[model samples]
Target: MPELNVMSEPSVRPPMTTGTGKPLSVTALRKTYGGVTAVDEVSMEIAAGEFVTFLGSSGSGKTTTLMMIAGFCEPDSGSIVVGGRDVTRLAPQKRGLGFVFQQYLLFPHMSVWENVAFPLQLRGVPKAELRRRVGETLEMAGLSAMSRRRPRELSGGQQQRVALCRALVYRPPVILMDEPLGALDKKLRDQLQTEIKRIQRELGLTVIYVTHDQEEALVLSDRIAVMRDGRIDQFDTPQELFERPRTPFVADFLGAANFLPGRVEEQTADHTLVRLDSGGLLKARPQPAPPPPPQAASRSASQAARVRAAVQPGRLALCPPEHGFCTGTVEAVTYVGTLVRATVRPLGGAPGDLVRLELPAGHAPALGERVGVTAAPANVSVFPDVVPDTESGG
Candidate 1:
């Protein structure tokens, strides 16, 4: 991985008002279309200079929420206050925010300098100021040497840098990015993730990023809002979200996990004992927390009894069939990088349900081998099951 020396470059924009990222607050934001709610009372507080990401699958309201924040998609009811000013009903341009789309959206006919200068020109900036600001932004993005090159003349990454310069040139208080790196390849994506973080830090720019890539969100965000079915399941630091997901969807969405279906036999302050349907028991640390309203407070006694233990594949170990938490027949094994991925079917679970684990390189069980999948109590997260989607909206 490169060191991302972009920050080390001489600062282009002044570290005053231009560098001071304005705080943002979204309250009770709701947007719906055709009686189908897209963003359901979505709200969050983003600090100045914070790098926040809206992470979720397609149709999960992340994009719609972002559009509302950008003033492109107006919320039906709610308020958006940036830097203490209400911009909920303002036009996109009037909100004074930067936006970078999945596509570079650069003017093919305009050179890098002109593209970066376009925003300034529209704001009626003087020629000298526009030229100086464009030059500084291009140099900051490491594109000064290519200022004369058109978008088609540059590589994808370079074009992206140009696009970034265009967004940053005006020094907007907040930069809202919707899968800006989605079009790039993995290698380049990795490189640009670091570069973007570096630039954001150097200028103290507040960034509101959106992406379906879990790894990308984990890599670039200081805080991630994990959305599902039009609402945020959890908003937390990556480590907290991964280590202690509030729901099975958050756990499964953020990482590879094995859900051992079971009913809660006992709940204690320190641990919850689960009786697996596959004829085994699991001890997960602490009790599962019910989700908040919308999906919260709706589970019946029987539905509440139906719970699952969520464990990351990396947290599990394979042992002798009689020695660990549960016994299963090895159904599949595959090599992934330095780790071996093994899938096992519990003795009596439903068909198509399997427990997966990441064994150390060369340590996976052979196919058809009976093995026990074990996890420490601290490694497991228990959540009320969502398989039977009921009125609770699992």
Candidate 2:
């Protein structure tokens, strides 16, 4: 991770009248199209200068919530409050928010400087002041040399930087980005992610970023709101979301997790003991809080009963069969750059029921080898098992 240039001294630049950044509050935002509900009562509070990502797969209502926040799409009900002012009914242009779309949205007819200056021009900023602001933004984004170039003349990444510069030129209190880096390749995306973070920090900008990419959300966000069916499933820091997901979907979506079918044998204030269906006891820290119930009745009784224990691939370690919590046979081994991943089939599990284990490259077992997998109780997360609905693709 690149170090953020957090300054202790006051900036020499003129103070923004619109406010550096302000807390954003979304209160029960709901939207429906025809008979299908797109967003269902989503609410979240974003602090000033904080970077929050709305993360979810397609049709999950992430984009709808962002659109409502941007004032582009009107909600059927609820309100959007920015800096303590209600802006739900305000026009997009009057909301005083910056926007960066996936397409870059740069005018082909305009030069890089002109693209960045468009917002200032719309606000009727004086020519001299506009020129100075645009120049400074271009320089900060390392695009001063390309100021004379058109959108077509720049690379995809450069075009994105130009788009970002345009959004920041006005210094809006909140900047909404809708998968702005989605068009670029992996290498370029990674580079731009770092650049975006650096710029956000330097400007103390409150950013509400939207992306379906889990890794991108994890990398860029100080906190993440994991959306599902138009509601937030979990809103938390990346580490918390990964280590203490409230639901199976969040756990499975954030990363690879081995879900062992189990029932809560004993629940206590600190720990919960579970009995695995295949055999053996496992222990996990009890969840202190349960997530908000889903808007629709979608969970099955069987799934609700089995959500007692879940462990990530990295948390499970190989142990002597006699001392292991669950014994299995190594069915396959894959070497992925820094770590080796093994597929293990539990001794009594149904055929095709396998667990993934991530181990040091040198410590991986050979195929057809017998292995016992056990995890420290501290690393395990106990929650109600949420079975995915095949038809709904939960």
Candidate 3:
């Protein structure tokens, strides 16, 4: 990549929470390929300079949505506005955007300096400016010492850094990263995660990063857009997404959740009592009046949460075998890192009654020991049963 010998001093500012200009907004974006709708009416707002991640499993249309925003895949309908300007029809190059793909996409025969300089050269920048820009970019990527190195000479992390420097050499306001760290090992991925965050912050670049890893999304994003079946399931900050998912799909996708089927039994001033079909009554913080009927109901858990009032009206339906819940004896235990996982049978009649609990391994519980498990009422969620067809929405 071409080295960026930056003549201009770019200020490293605080990570952006809001757009310095108007927010980047996508309105009713839709794309269809033959019989499959790749991206279906996806709409979201990305604050300028904020790192927003599109996270989903394969074939979930996250890549399609990113491509549409980059103008590589034209949307059949809807609009993309950046900093208040509608750029739905703009060419990818003309949009002043930088993109880094999973494969690095560097010319193997080209020197690192040349690779970094390619963007500037494409823009018809002066030779002096190109050299300066590429040199500075190389330094920013921590590769000034290896400007002549080929892709094969560098580590996977370093190669991706070169790709990133290539994307940033022009100092574009927006950057798109498509699984740039996907191929790296766990340690390198962790290292580059910090680097990517630092570079994005230092350059004040608005980023649309895509990945299927929930941990990556949580660690890196100011907000996450969870896509499913060509549509956005939910969009929220990591904390909000984890704590109060608007949909069952969002809750389940972000982490392990316990779901129970229930119906609104009564609404009081401070709580809504719902009767579970699984033989339990659940209390939930009262939702707004005229709340939408519970659809695809589910609840997320940090660990095995206890329901103090759960057994009042009905039996506990499902509990994670990792968190201690259920009335049966401990069947087995597995120690993993700082936590120990125990499986128990709440109902002795079936083998599947195993409830898992996550507890400190320092003072591990004994096997075959009968233990009582309880989770707070607030931790449990009461909702309608899930549909058979839509089992995995997250």
Candidate 4:
């Protein structure tokens, strides 16, 4: 871990009222390690009760940003406003926020009840209130019957529930979870995802979750912030990000996409016409235009920008060579459980250039077969091909 050259110990406590969730705001947050920028001008305005996930691969600055919000890291310049109170300089413990980490972080010798009651005990709550809160939280997590078991004796899922109960015992207005289910197996993780969502909505807690799993982000987030390099590539509802990404990185990150490099031949409010570099004309849905370049640039120069049409594997259809938008030869076929995925090598494309298609099971296209691959224009998203290095990738 890189060192954080930050120091602060504010004595003020956060507002920890329990009821409706509270809003969170991050503005112009930036962090650096030596000369490399880890988080660049990251900003968000999260609504009360909204579950937002920071989705990115490792070292993309998602964790760094979350740490800054939790007061575990210090930002070089930024403001963290939680529930309308600025807590940028506040200490972690003083922030009075809930956190559930990947590791259980439970006390080995303590029973579930003792573990859940720990935070309230530190706050010096009355014994009656502490017991009431702990019991209520345990019940909410469906762990009431096992409240007497020690962490070591419980199953992994149960242990995680204890950790979650511990975080919620204090009824913090906001919760920060860092891949809390990363340690579990797929079945357990899927089961717990539902449990976590149920508890969150039942309590109306504002949640900031961090995860690298695209499926997890899609299943859990009300809105997702897809991070790349050191900046947010896109932040929107899961449906919007998946169906209407404005950048190639966003399209590829949220889900696999085949980017057909091209130049914009014509553009309208609803769609764009692209002449693919491989000698095929294609239509794609128009994305929000990128911000214009400097004032000194010429209009004709702006019109010459390169673009790409991003189509998902599922959207690509295999057809007879003469019927497709472009002709290709089937180079590889993969037997995914419910689908047959085939890779097509375009006739005029480079040796490494390949387009993949997902066909229904039993509709396999034989390897080395001649075919045409095409996708509907409306199903394709078009974006500016030139992306800044900071938003290019993790």
* lDDT tens digits by residue: candidate 2, 1-394: 2211211222354633333777899999999999988899898999999999998888889888999999889999999999999999999989999999999889888888788888888798877677767777887798988988889999999999999999999889899999999989999999999999988888889999999898999999999998887778899999999988877778878886788877777778887788887787888876553332353246664445555467899888998877777888999999998899999898887676788999998898989988888998888886655554322323
TM-scores vs. true structure, each candidate: 0.87, 0.89, 0.80, 0.87
Q: Provide the lowest-lDDT 10-residue window in model 3.
A: 306-315
Instruction: Using TM-score, give the best candidate's number.
Output: 2
Against the true structure, whose lDDT is highest?
1
**Order the candidates by lDDT, highest first — what do you get?**
1, 2, 4, 3
For every candidate in turn, the CA RMSD to the true structure comes to 5.6, 6.2, 6.9, 7.4
Better of 1 and 2 by lDDT: 1
Clash count per candidate: 0, 3, 40, 1
Q: Of 1 and 3, which scores higher on lDDT?
A: 1
Candidate 1 — which pairs collide? none
Question: Cα lDDT for residue 75, model 2?
Answer: 97
Per-residue accuracy of model 3 over 59-141 as CA lDDT, tens digit each: 88999999988889899999999877888999987788789999999999887877888888879898766766676667767
Global local distance difference test of model 3? 0.71
Quote the lDDT for 12 in model 2: 51
The Cα error of candidate 3 at residue 143, in Å, is: 1.8
